[model samples]
Target: MELVVYLAGQIHDDWREQLKQLAEQKGLPLVFKGPQEDHDRSDEIGEAIKGTQPSSIYRDHTASEFNNLRTRIWMNKADVVIAQFGEKYRQWNSAMDASIALATGKPLILIRPESLVHPLKELAQRAQCVVETPEQALEALAYVFE
Candidate 1:
């Protein structure tokens, strides 16, 4: 059977595509899913489709809610969740996604550098697998989807 995998967080990088490619190369029966990857488009879709908001906060709120619709659905349907934390930014969304994955009993694999291990200790503890690279995350996927 084909497994649905949620590619969450750190959309700034190409990690999602990389992991999908790896899965394809391995002949794994997997389908990669995620919120919209286009940052500008994801942000603007709310205002574009539903009309503009009054202020920055309202605009962001609208956008967040719009994105959350897709995210929530995917999280529920996902057999596995790989949440990536990038080095430059505070990836709070990733942390949230990981928590949701655990709460929903979806197998979670977190990708973040060694530097974050201490700060994200609690979150890491709850995950099924934690790795530093997308390739390593792919390894976890291979094992699960194989």
Candidate 2:
């Protein structure tokens, strides 16, 4: 089964890169989306990540109500959703994704930033698991995919 992870776009570069590596390693598909950086940049970014290619691209971006609707539509087809809720918190987008994941009862993996930490010890108490390192992420991935 393939799981769709809702990644945080504003995340640290290293983290995002690590996530991509992890996805490839796990043979899982991932994608991230945001207000097109610009009309031109949007196409470039979208093509690079999504393209018309037959690859799984996870679209994780701050979404408005309408955007959230679109996200939900996409998410329903996913096996799971992994969201990185670092120090920065945008109530609408982050919470919206989390809530949807919760409502759908899909597995949710919450990744905290290495630098800025989360006060909540158990980020996702109900999440299949909460992880701190990339390696941990892989372990969690195994569980979700298996």
Candidate 3:
């Protein structure tokens, strides 16, 4: 099944790589959003995704570009959004993520570590599901896609 995963850019780069790998392994199409990168990593990640699954949307567009306006456009097309919730960082696109997901009423899978503190618990409760691990996120995505 196809899944659109919206990750916060402020998280570690390795986490993005891991989620991408997991998606590829599951034969699930992934849509990634976050930090800017050079040509090589971009090509590699794209190739990895293409190798195993149906074509997916990779939004290189900045969350700021959406700024509630653009996201409303794309959110309608996305089936699911996997986001890092309750994180505060200068680069974090929490507002864009929450607004778009909430607006679309798409199934939102929010991922947060057990140790992390979050103010979005109620929001997550309102979401399709709240996950504590990548595995949980994947499971939630599966449910959403189903």
lDDT of each: 0.88, 0.55, 0.58
Report the C-alpha lDDT of model 2 over 1-146, residue by residue, as the tens digit: 44555553233335656766777776765553322223344334534554443443332231223344556676676666666655654434445565677788877766656553445354466666666665676567766556
Q: Judged by lDDT, which candidate is best?
A: 1
Compared to the true structure, candidate 1 yields what TM-score? 0.95
State how far residue 120 of model 2 sits from its true place (Å): 3.6
Cα misplacement distance, residue 14 of candidate 2 (Å): 5.9
TM-score of each: 0.95, 0.58, 0.60
What's the residue-level lDDT of 56 in candidate 2?
Answer: 33
Better of 2 and 3 by lDDT: 3
By TM-score rank, best first, the candidates go 1, 3, 2
- Candidate 2: residue pairs that collide: 30-57, 30-58, 31-57, 31-58, 31-59, 32-58, 32-59, 32-60, 33-60
Could you tell me the TM-score of candidate 3?
0.60
lDDT, candidate 3, 1-146, per-residue tens: 45555564345346667877887788766776543334344434444544433333433332223344434555666666767643445435654575567777767777766645355656666677777776778766655556
Count: clashes, candidate 3: 0
C-alpha positional error of residue 97 in candidate 1 after TM-score superposition, expressed in Å: 0.8
lDDT of 1 by residue, 30-138 (tens): 8999879999999897898779789888888899988988899999999889899989887978988888899889989889899998998998988988999999988
What's the true lDDT of residue 143 in model 1?
A: 77
**Higher-ranked by lDDT: 1 or 3:** 1
Q: How many steric overlaps does candidate 1 have? A: 0
Ten-residue region with minimum lDDT total, candidate 1: 137-146
